[model samples]
Target: MDSDEDTFDNDNVDSGNVSSGDDDFAMEVDISSSRERQTEPEEYHYEVLTTDQIVQDMVDSISDVNGVVNLPRTITRILLNHFKWDKEKLMEKYFDGNEDKFFQDAHVVNPFNKPNTISVPKVTKSTTDEICEICFSRNPSGMMTGLECGHRFCKQCWGEYLTTKIMEEGVGQSISCAAHGCDILVDDVTVTKLVPDAKVRVKYQHLITNSFVECNRLLRWCPSADCTYAIKVSYVDARPVVCKCGHTFCFDCGENWHDPVQCRLLKKWLKKCDDDSETSNWIAANTKECPKCNVTIEKDGGCNHMVCKNQNCKHDFCWVCLGSWEPHGSSWYNCNRYDEDEARAARDAQEKLRSSLSRYLHYYNRYMNHMQSLKFENKLYASVKHKMEEMQQHNMSWIEVQFLKKAVDILCQCRQTLMCTYVFAYYLKKNNQSMIFEDNQKDLETATEKLSEYLERDITSENLADIKQKVQDKYRYCEKRRKVLLDHVHEGYEKDWWDYTE
Candidate 1:
């Protein structure tokens, strides 16, 4: 039996095409080479991978490179990391360049061009008198360890150094040798064998895996809070990707799939909001500076006569005309000297400032309203589930009452789309196409509100069928209108029909 608080959750399906059971917002890219235009909206394709899977993929990449280069796995891993896990780029540079120089640039010794030196096993018990470069101690009983560079250090010093680098410094992929001037890197095998503490070892492994994911352009860690999954895409683009955790975000910028508004504009919009720069806009629109002393003043009273509160310059002026009050004398209440060029220009500038502020607030208010509504999505889902149970108790089957849940789902999606539309509209320049886009936004907004209202209405056995039909009709209309708006925006993008102010 499904609980009254059941939410929509699904596992990641491994497929070439992006699919989220009933979610229409999942985007996919068309990889097929056809000059003919397709009718469907563009979508993105990606895979959600677990941490263990990410590690395994890293190992597989190392193995693949090792297969062709015939190098040790440890050396292959370092080379792959140096190239940011790009196998093709690593291969290109490895075969086409000077092998010794390439290895030196990567800070790894070429196993093939090694000078004639004694090959002592790492972490071996010391038999002859040798001073550890790190500790500067010649211990007869302590173990000695070193990399291929042959600068041996006491085993105790190696553990301490590796622990500091891994646990304290957070260095994972490119940790150089413990020797002072040696640039030879310590491989994962040597690190694992040297670091005795289980916690440090695990942290080192995690850091390595995270670095692999972060450095690779094809991968992105899911931005959902507390989610451990990472998404792997074949190519990078500002396309929507859905994680197995049911969180959908843009693979490029990691924001919620904000169609209509491109990633760069959305980034600028977010920065503007976070900076709270609109408060200064409001100040500029509402308040004026004193003409004489230039002291900033806000008119709190309704009187047109204004006095500069500055101690040095107590100049009297008219608030509306910003003209000297001495011209009016006792007729200050009806100052007709408003046509002066200076005052006219001042008023014009203030009007322009107010208009700009009004435009920003218009879009910002709508965007924030939808964002606020989406925060209650879980409550809406729970309310719909309860209604579903009530309908079930009134002789309706469990499947029959699913329309309520589906309507809520569509309502939430509509809200998200609506939120992004305002962002798109905020930057859009006024034109015939923009007018049509606004009309589309209006239609979608109307249908979404109707659907949301229908979902929140109390359901009873008396009007179950009637409400069911109405809810279904409204949600279908909402979904249809949403698609229309998005499709128009996509068309605008392709045909260069839309223009931005910034």
Candidate 2:
């Protein structure tokens, strides 16, 4: 009889394609026929074994040859011998497996490893009482089928298990298959196949993709063992991550370019970039340079007169104020302070007011003297007094009052020339003590009352003129007082009693 190795090799032969030229063709055919006699139907094989025939054959061969002596049987015997036989006790023992075998391949190894072959633990339909790994609940909905590890669990339990594992531990990381003693990672492809619902499959795929994406895209936590948090990419260029342990790095220094803590020394260095012009230029070249001192000045406004901040060479004219370290060379002018045209215009206006007021005062005094000389008659005197009272009520100045008195006197002179006899007779009758005197006195009294009422109650054009002149005089006086105070202060007499009183 052929040995098992030859039978296995013959079983693997491709029957459809035959190499006719080979001299060993007859032997190959005979071996193939014998292997075919030993083989069972494909359906029966599949039903009795795992999807992979090689794994099924290996398991069958190991079980047949070792009986109670192989690694699997030894693990089962060890579990039974070490613990009291109960469902929970058996599960706990089975789940832990043999420590030596479990930890033989364990270490902080790289995640990228070749596919591992796992020995399926001996689990029975009766031993399927383990709670769902996710919810830790005993109520499972359907029969459990594991990916490759013969670790069977309820379908609902397995799904929840995968979801929790993916969400918490993340993909590509190894997790024990839900079946006890079956230490196999539920990798991306296995997760996709086991999770049958369309939505769940998609979610698992997304999670797996996101895991790789996050490894590349997310900011890395500072590798400094004590640092806890990660920094984002946006804060990389200017403000770098600083650690409490005094380690500082630029935004792009680390693999993730993320630092949570800011460095005190790095912050100081960044601040120097703001203060030192050369340092600022090194960081960002577009900063404006002051023409006067050649130091960098940050441009805040639109004007071209760049002021240097260097104290020794702070020489730049403000185009707006025309004030700078050096004079404007007589070309630039500030009308408010030293413009000749405005100064001349202001002087001419002041001189005109002074000359006009002087002439007005002279004319006003002459008219007043003339009025005083003719104003002895009671009726005429009453008229002049009434006009004066009206001017005083309107807050008119003495000069303005004199002007009004002159205007009234001119009117009176015109009336006297037009009707001199009527005026003289009226005046004489008012003075005489006869029968006609009472009538003339009554007429004079009536005329005096009407004129007094007009003067006291009404605002005539002459009254308005006097009011305007008084206002102008008050304004001029106030201006003069202000100028005197300013002059006194400028001359170092600010603390004098007169200066305080003024």
Candidate 3:
């Protein structure tokens, strides 16, 4: 992945006009412009929506269905929930499927074919013999409520039932009526009327919003901590979605937008790194087994001569060749005889384990180095922002100081790209094309490190111009290298030039 360069452009656009604030509308504008300038349009399109916007979208969807079906809003919402908020599917099924069965399946009463259920009378004193199903008390008509299914309960009982479902159970859109064995869903209006406590009602609303986002295939909550925004995409794919909080994630897997390595491979790499079983593999890689008794041994001393301490089998051997120590005679340090089958077999086995460990560490260390480097990116941003302010004090415009921030952005991009490349390289099987990819990785890594160095170097009045030139030059080169690396990787993906090992 390209580290989502376009997603960060909005933060620096027209530097003079930009200010730190809560609004992200400017970001949406910048994204639109960025997409227009691209030679190849992005595979996915998305919108960052707030809570109110999501609610409005739900209302709009309900209105759209109501325009065609002409059902009550409450019943329409139940039908939509049944279809997972898919209007077209709900419409198709409503028109094509048997009407009575459709309403029954959705746990709703058909508004078109209304059944003669007990009518809820107007608010008044308890004059008629109306017994509440829940409390079994003959309460006033005004003190009782229920869904269209007519399983009425006292107001107190309804409030408790809704509170348990919303606050305790976390059930929102699919909360059914309180009547025993009745699966008919309670609609939002009834919930709002019955649940009088503002806190519980608020929680119920949040739960409904969460359900809408989760159930809809086109929507995803931004994965950043404490961010309340959700992304609505035109379609699902492994493309980046930048939330208003500036967290860019992949729409498909909800991970940080990782290019070069696909989602499945990244998942496998994370699992491998997290697995504790690799500790034993490390021991096998670093230590050797006693040739005679099959006990593990570690060489901590300068001498190569070894002896197994298994009391029953006090076997003596040379650590270098795992052969009988007696054969060395006086040439102890220079034992070159490997004609023994046991020694050759032991040597081969040890080397195989060591080679596997060495290969994994090579890629793992580089991957981790880049990841660790990314941790400093936030501190780097703070440093660059201070530098920008200092440059403005030196008779430079805000526009002139903007390059410092831009450099930091590109540097972060390069670091993220380099981090994901190791995950790509680890599973890659060696071939001519793999060698080319390694070359690209090397070029990007070298440029990224130099860029990082320049950013950290001290800036002063005497070296201001020189520092600006160097920082600009380094970041541009780093950007070019990153693009070239990603382009090659993407091309390889299309051409099937790369192969992976287990």
Candidate 4:
């Protein structure tokens, strides 16, 4: 299960013509060519498979293969693992009727002539009993089974070996033959038959089920703490694929769904945020250097006249320009404005330093603004929620005030989305399309503010019903507006609609 094959390569699917429909939201691209669009709600649009469902799907896939070619399920699992669990490709490659290569490649001894059995190498044995390789017993008690690799061990020893591999060693489905240096996979046949412990067998099957999800590059375990769901999406569109678990994430980066900004920029932005670059940069910018020893010196509010603290280098220099302060003698604040040309690299480094800091600040400020606003809006929501409970004492149900809760939730989501958009926009190469996106972002921000205000209002006010209704309307408006902005950017990315400066 090589991951390189799972990388989202943009396939040459036909980019259908964009159709313009009844557009009212900010910067709407008309998908008119969609031709009689059906109202497919977002909730029902995708599939979410639990562990059981995923395992059942694999079973069904194997069953489909078995129907055409009567291979044992043990052989089938091997083939599936070999083909990275892609059944269609496996069938296409295997089912050309020249099947010896398939069996050989999968290392299944072809029993084509004697159809019902695996063809292991013939071994001379006494009519009495055989010696087990693992336990080195003379078949004293139980049954003995031989693998295709012709390694035979007593059933008890085999169970312990498989159990150790599955449970203690955590080998998953790839437990190998007991023969030393042999990589031949001990199939599920041997595992289930020889592994007599129900617990160990269950663990083996559980690990195999999880392996199919983990080893295959196309699937991901849901990041939710208690979630056991997996999502399947087109490999070509490796953007935000939402799970039914309500956890939307970038299939590309495995982080929470970051639209507009590509995974690379998101990684860079996050690393920049996490590090001390900003703090260190501020320090570096403010601190003066002792030119002799090149040591940093912070100003504690004095005249620009300064001396190097190092005893060896009693170099007197202007704190501002790092030039000799001999001309000014005692007090010289004007030295702070000293301007002189330096090396080319230093000048370029200074320019780049400023540019990087400014760029980061631009994105960070907007990100923080919407985030702070969302925090305040959430507080307001909690307050109003308390009011709803208080009103419940006056005979109002939680259902009756759920609209307030929903409005606040939508507001928060929209603002957070709007916050992330600024980071995306900051990296966006300025073009007509991005400019249009910015306009949409601005409009969404405006609508989100209005929604936040409505959600934050007092229940003590007159026309509570009207206020709630307005809040609902604003919620709908903000959500739709946010979707449009994101959807447009997503489309732009998918269709190569914009350029990036970075």
How many Å off is the CA of 323 in candidate 3? 15
Residue 191 lDDT (model 1): 79
Residue pairs that clash (backbone atoms under 3 angstroms), model 4: 19-30, 19-31, 19-32, 19-33, 20-30, 20-31, 20-32
Question: Which has the better lDDT: candidate 2, or candidate 4?
Answer: 4
**lDDT-based ranking, best first?**
1, 3, 4, 2
Candidate 1 wrong stretches, greater than 4 Å: 1-43, 114-137, 140-142, 148-152, 178-184, 286-339
Error of 1 at 220 (Å): 1.6
Q: lDDT of each structure?
A: 0.78, 0.38, 0.77, 0.66
Model 4: runs farther than 4 Å from truth? 1-45, 95-144, 215-220, 232-244, 249-254, 262-344, 365-386, 389-402, 432-436, 446-450, 461-473, 487-497
> By the TM-score metric, which is better: model 2 or model 3?
3
Q: What is the total number of backbone clashes in candidate 3?
A: 2
- Per-residue alpha-carbon lDDT of candidate 1 for residues 52-80, written as tens digits (9 for 90 to 100): 68777887887788789888777887888
* Model 4 per-residue lDDT tens digits across residues 10-117: 221111112222232111111110111112113223356766577766677677887876777767777888888887888998867777787667655554632333
What are the RMSD figures for all models against the true structure?
A: 9.0, 45.8, 8.9, 10.1
Off by over 4 Å in 3: 1-44, 112-142, 274-358
Candidate 3 structure, TM-score to reference: 0.76
Comparing 1 and 4 by TM-score, which wins? Answer: 1
Best by TM-score: 1
For model 1, the run of ten residues with the poorest summed lDDT: 27-36
Q: Can you give the TM-score per candidate against the true fold? A: 0.81, 0.20, 0.76, 0.69
In candidate 2, what are the lDDT values of residues 425-487, reduced to their tens digit?
A: 222222223234234323433343333233333455565775545434433333333233223
